[model samples]
Structure formats: structure tokens, C-alpha cells
Target: MKIAFVANTCWNIYNFRKGLVHHFLSKGDEVIVLAPKDEYTDRIKSWGVKWLDTPLEGTSVNPFREFKYLLRIYSIFKSERPALALTYTIKPNIYSSLVSKWTPTKVICNVSGLGTIFLTTGLIGKLALILYRQAFKFSSYVFFQNSDDRELFTSKIKVESYKIGLIPGSGINLEQFKPLAFTQNTKTKFLMISRLIIEKGVREYAEAAKAFKDDKNVAFTLVGKFDTNHSRSIDEKELKQWITNGWIQYQPHSDNISNIIESHDVIVLPSYREGTPRTLLEGAAHARPLLASDVPGCREVVKNGYNGFLFEPLNSSSLINKMKLFLSLSIDEKKHLANNSRELVEKNFDEKLVVDAYEEAIHRIIKVS
Candidate 1:
């Protein structure tokens, strides 16, 4: 069977969902990659998957541009005639599902987190929900990374519960991210690995870091690059100011995420929401304690005084309080958190679970369709 994975960016497919691609290929199924071409397209093609470039403006809300994107997606599906279409991110999920409705392609939508528009109570949020409701009602299946997201999306859109599936975020390769022994130092290092954008809770992280300015021992660090094209991006001038003022140490994005994790003590992600926080999985795999917002995807990772602690969303004070609690932990307490972190990831969030699930879902869809 020929299967297609539709996403907004080829980078997302190559980097995040590579395991799932391998699963289909290993099963002797032909896999097609569809997304806006970038540097990673060649890399993805080298993996033996066929690439079809589908142009899109990821951050745009303009209906005219979105309509064009939708039509282009429809044209691709109409021509390729894939047996099954698996879509990730916002544009691909909705637009691809819409196209599948008119084609023989059976679409499986992966709700990889609701982006900025869904977080808002304004016109954009309402508009996005309406579109989601329309496209999803016709979908073959809906896969959510966490139950909270599945419940929220299905409740709003009225989809079949039988059609809903759950996956741990694209998932973390335990072999690549397995735990390393750590020792506590007088200076507790806190690190946040994320794109520099507002919705990622960058501002909240910055504020929480600022609250610890007078603490000479603890260091607040951010690792990841600025996402310039994204609408929720942090202002370049302000980011520079944060660095200049010595509020936080900003590290450039690196290919070796495990190396970056090794250099930090505690991993933090105060994101407003997520499909699942990949960084937390990476950190936990490396046996590092976590700090995250007490929201959906985040809560799935942190089990309050278990693997790590959870704080109120958007509350810098709450984050600061959690940080303080983490710092005050005895060596035994810290070790307990680290042990739990590794155990939790090993038992639940292994990357194989996600890839195998996708393969099974695609096979089942093909068998029944």
C-alpha cells in the first residue's frame, strides 16, 4: 500500500516523525512525503521516501492564502491517489482532510497540539474551531498525543469516539536519549529548550528567570533559536536586551540535544499547551527532573513530586516557587526525581509505541477501506 504523511514542513517530518516513516518502510509499504520543501527535503528523500513539495504559509490566517493552500493540497491528493494520508500540524490536518473528503484517500489527522489561534478567545479562535469542526467531521480517524487534547477537540467538533486514537508525542528514541549519571552542584542550572516564541511560554520563562536574579548560585539558561517567520516570535530587540541585561544565558540551537541536556540540571518548559512536550521526554530520558506548566501536554510529563513538579500556567510566581522547591530538595529527593523521570519515560513514552501505532492504524485503515 502507498501511504502519505502530510505536514506543514519537511523539517517536521524528517526530525520529529522519522520513526513512523521507518515503520511503514519496514513493512514494505511505499511512503510519500508531502510538505513545503526546505533543506531537509533532500535529507528526507535520501531516506527513500518520495517527496512532493506542497507550498504553504504556516503562520498565516488569511482565508485567500489558506484557500490556495487547500487547493494545492487537493490537487496533490487527487493526483497521487494515496491509499492512506496521515497529517500533522494545523494546515495539513484540516486542509488535507478536506481534500480527502472528495478523493479516495482516507485521512488520519494527528492533532499535534492546537496552535496559537486555538489558544485565543478572539475571532481567529472562533474561525479556526469552525474550520476544524467542518474538516474533522469527514475524517477517517483522529490521533491525539494526549487525552486532554482528544477530549477537547472531539467535544468541540463532534467526531466518532471509535475513530479517536492516542499516541505519546511522535516519541523519543530511548537509545539516543537514555539517562546519564548526574551530580548536583552548588549552582543549580535550569534550562529551557524551545523556539523563542510567545506561545512557547518564552515570556513567562524570562519573567520567572528574572525573579531569581539575586540568586548567585542558580543559572537560568535557554537553548534554541529564534523562529523569525512565526507570528508569535519574540522581538529580536527584546531578546538581545534579555541577554545584555544578564537575565538569562541564551544558547544557539544545536543538533546534539542530548549534549545540551547533559550540561543542564533541571529542564523547564512552561508552554501554554502542547501535543506533548518533546524536550521534557528528552530530558526525562536523560534522567533530568522537569518543571512545566500545569496544562494538558505538560501534566502528562510531570507527575507532581514524582518525576518533577507542575506549576500554574502563565504564572511566573508559580514557576519561581517550583524552582525554589526543586533547588531546596535534598540530594536523596533529587535522586528520586531523576530515577522516576527515567522510569516514567522507559515505561510509557518510548518512540516505538508511536511508530508502531501509526503503522497499525494505517494497515487497519487499508484493510477496512
Candidate 2:
């Protein structure tokens, strides 16, 4: 069987779905990729999967542009004639499903997360819901990273229950993110790994760090790239101001996420929303305690007091209070929490489990189609 993965970014596939792609290839299935090409496009081709460079404008929401995109996707789907099409992100899921409706091929759409448009009940949100309702109704299976998202889509967007499936984000590789031995270091270092965007609460984390700057024993590190497309991106000027004022130590994003998690005492993600935070799962798999917002995606991974503590979304004082609580725990207690985090991930969020489930879903669609 020929399998095709349709995504907005090749980087997402490279970062999260490499294992799934390898699993299909190992089983002697022909695998192809359909996405906008970037630096990673050639790299994926080097790994033996065929690449179809479908050009798309940057994550824009203009109706005219989106219609043009749908036409382009339809052309690609007609030419490729994949036996199964697995799509991720907004445009790929809706447009690819719409295009594949004419073919006998099965379509699997992963609603990774409902982005900014779905967070409100305004015009755009209503429009997005209508689009999702229509698009997802046609999917052979719609995979969601968290139950909260699934419920939201089912209730608000009016998607069918039987079409929905659950996955633990893209999932974390336990072998790649092994548990680190807890060692007492002089400084209680806290790391926040995410795109430096306002919606991710980057500024809130900085303010909270400033509140604790007097504590000489605790250090805060911010790691991630600046997302130019996000409306609330932390611009160069703001980032420079934060660094110059000594609010937190800043580090550029790196592919070496496991090592980054290992070096930190605690991991933080103050995101306003998520599908499921891949960083928090990675940190937990590396036996690191968490401090994240009490939002949908974050709460799913950090169980308030069990594996980690949660703060109010976008509340700097709340984040500061949680950070203080984490700092007050004894070294042994912290280690115990870290161990529990890894145990939770091992049992519920293993990367192989996600791959196996996806493979089974695709095969089932193929068998029954």
C-alpha cells in the first residue's frame, strides 16, 4: 500500500512523525510526503520517502488564498493517487480531505490543536467551527491529542463521534528521552521551551522570573525560536530588552531537546493553549518535574500536584507562586515527582504506542475501504 503524509511543515513530520514514517517503510509500504518544502524537504528525501513539494502561503487565513490552496491540494491528490492520506494541521486536514473525497483512498486527519481562531466565540471562531464540521465529517478517522479537544470539537463543531480517535500528542520517544539521575546542583534551574510568542506566555514567564530574581540560588532559562507568523510574537526589541534587564537567561532553540531537558532542574510551559505540549512530555520522559499553565493541553500532562504543579493561564503572579512552591520542595521530593512524571509518560505517552495506533487505523481504513 502507498501511504502519504500531508502536513503544513516538513519540520513537524521530521520532529514528531519520523518513527511512524520509519515503521511504515520497514513494513515494505511505499511512503510519500506532501507539504511545503523548506530546509527539511531534501533531508526527508534523503531518508528514502518521496517528497511532493506543494507550495502554500504562510499560515494565512484569507478566504481567497485558502481557496487557491484547496485547488492546489486537489491537483496534487489527483496526481499522487495515494492509497491512504494522513494529514496534520489546519489547512492540510480540511483541504486534503476535501480533495480526497472524490477518490477511493482513505483519509486520516489529525487535529493536532485548535489554534487561535477557535479560542473565541466570535465571527472567525464560528466560521472555523463550520469549516471543521464540514471537513472532519468526511474524514475516515479524526485523531485528537487530548480528550478535551475531542469533546470541544464534537460538541461545538458538531463532528461525528465515531470518526474521532485519541492519541498522546505526536508522542515522545522514551529511549531518546531517558530518565536522568537526579543530582543536587547549586542552582535550581528552570527551563521554558516553546516558541517565543505572547500566546505561549513568554512575557508572563519573564515577569514571574523577575519576581524571583532576588533568589540567588534559582536560575531561569528561556529556550525557543521567535515565531514570526504568530500575531503575538516576541519581537527582537522585546527579546533584547528582557535579556539586557536580566529577567532570564536566553538560549536559541536547538534540536538537542533531550540534553536541554537533562540540564534543567524543572521544566515550564506557560502556554495559553496546546494540542498536547510535546516539550512537557519530553521533559517528563527525561524525569523532569513541570510548571505549566492550567490550560487544556498543559493540564492533560501535568496533574496539578502529582507529576507537577499548574499555574493560572497568563497570570504572572500565579506562575511566581507555583515556582516558589516547586522551589520549596525537598530534593528527595522533587526526585520522586520527577520519577512519577517519567512513569506516567512511560505508561500513557510512549511514541511507539502512537505509531502503532496510527498504523492500525490506516490499515483498517485500507481493509474496509
Candidate 3:
């Protein structure tokens, strides 16, 4: 059987779906990837899978460009004709599924998150919803990262309930992100890792960090790529201002995320929403306590005062309060939170669970076909 994984970027498929791809390859299934070429394209090709460059500009809404993208995917399906097509991100899920309606290929769409499209009430949002409903009508299955997303789609879209499923984000590799021995740092280190975007609460994080700027006992670190291309991306000038104000230290995105997580005492995500953030999962797997917004995907992982604490989404004051509360904990109390973090990931969010779900879905679809 041939399986093709499609997404906006080669990097996304390489990092998030590598386990599932490896699972199929180990089972002697031919696996191919369709995504825009990036630094990770060659790396994915090295894994003994075919890599097809499919140009997809995620933020572009130009009708002509979108039509071309659709035609390109249609051509790929017509030629490759894989038994199963797994798609992630907005464009792939909507466009590839549309193409699958006329092709022999069967598509499984992964709704990682609604993103900015669903956050607005504008024409774009309504159009996106309509597109989703039409594309999903042809999909073999639609996998959501959180229950809230599933409920939203089922309520607003006309897709059948049986065609929907829930998956734990992309799942985390426990062994690779195992808990390290905790050591008390001179200052309580709080780390936030995400694209520097407005919807991600980058501004809120900076404000919270600014609140404790005069104190030497608390330190904040921000790590992520400066995504100037994103509509909601934080301005480089503002980021520089925050750094100049001595509120937080900034680091460019790094491949050594595990080591970076280990160096911090707590992981924080102030995003307005999520589809099960991989950062929180990685932090939990490393036995680092979490501080995240009380949104659907986040609340699923963070049991308030259990493994971590939750704050009001987009509320800097609430984040500050939680940070202060965490800082007030004794060494033993802090360690307890850390231990619970690791325990939670062990009980759930293992990478194998995601691989198993995809494998089962593929087998079921194949059996039906």
C-alpha cells in the first residue's frame, strides 16, 4: 500500500508526523510526502521515502493562486494515486480533500487547530468554514486535536459524526524528552516557546515579564522564530523594545528544544487557543510544570494545580498571578508539580498512541475500500 502525507511545509511533516511515517515504512508500506521544499525536505528524502515539492503559500488568499494550488494537488493525485492521503494544515486539508473526491485516493484530514481563520467573524472565516464543510464531505475521516474543535466543526459543519475522531496533538516522544534531574536555580526560570505572533500571546508574555523586571529572583526566556510572514506576527521593533527593557531574554529557534526545556523550571504558553500545543507536551514530558491559557487544548493537558496551572486566555494579569503563585512554592512543592508533569505525559500523549491511531485508521479505510 502507498501512503502520502501532505502539509504546508516539509518541516511540519518531518517534525510532527515523522513517527507515523516511520511506522508505515517499518511495516513495509511505501510512504511519500507532498509539501513545499525546505531544509527538511532532503532529511525526509533520506528516510527512504519519495518527496514531492508541492508549492503552498499558507497565508495567500488570492483566488488565482489558490486555484493553481488546487490544480497542482489534483495533478499529484492523478499521477501518484496513493491508497491513502493524510493531510495537515488548512490548505492541504481543504484542497487535497477536494481533489480526492475525484481521485482514487482517500484522504484523512487532521484539524490541528482552527487558527486565525476561525478566530474572526469576517468573510474569510465564513468562506473557510464553507470550504471545510465541502472538503470534509469527501474525506475518509477528519481527526481533531481537541474535543472543542471537534464539537465546533460538528456543530457548524455538515460532516457526519462517525467520520470524526480525536487525536492527542501530534503526540510526544517520551524517551527522547525524558525528565531530567531537577536542580534548584538561583532564579525561577520561566520559558515560553512559540511563533512570535499576536494570537500566541507574545505581547502578554512580555507584559508579564515586565511586571517582574525589577526583581532578580525571577527570569523569563522567549524562544521561537520571528515569523514576519504571519499576519499576526509580532513586530521586530516591539520584540527589540522588550529585550531592551530587560523584561525577557530572546533566543532564536533551536533544534535542541529538549535541552532548552531542561534548563527552564517552568514552561508557559499564553496563546489564545491551541490544537494541543507540542511545546506544552514536550515540557510535560521533561517533567517541567506548565503555565498556559485555560483554552481547550491547553486545559486538556494542564490539570489546574495538578501538573501545572492555567490562566485566563490573553489575560496578562492572570498569567502574572500564576507566575507569582508558582514562585511562592517551596522546593518540594515545585518538585511535586514537576513529577506530576512527567506522570501525566506517561499516562497520555505518548507518540505511539498517535502512530497506532493512524495505523488503525489506514487499515480500516483499506478494508472498506
Query: Which candidate number would show the highest TM-score if scored against the true structure?
Result: 3
Please report, in order, the local distance difference test score of every candidate based on alpha carbons: 0.87, 0.84, 0.89
- Per-residue lDDT over 55-130 for candidate 1, one digit per residue giving the tens place of the 0 to 100 score: 8887678889999898888887888888889998877888888887899999999888876546877665777788
Which ranking of candidates, highest TM-score first? 3, 1, 2
The TM-score that candidate 1 achieves is 0.95
- Clashes per candidate (backbone, < 3 Å): 0, 0, 0
Candidate 1 local Cα displacement, residue 16, angstroms? 1.4
Residue 360's lDDT in candidate 3: 78
Candidate 1 vs candidate 2: which has greater TM-score?
Answer: 1
Report how far off residue 8 is in candidate 3 (Å): 0.6
Which ranges of candidate 3 are over 4 A from the true structure?
none
RMSD of each: 1.8, 1.9, 1.3
After superposing candidate 1 on the true structure, give the runs of residues whose Cα lies further than 4 Å from its correct spot.
Answer: none
Clashes by residue pair, model 2: none
Global Cα lDDT for candidate 3: 0.89
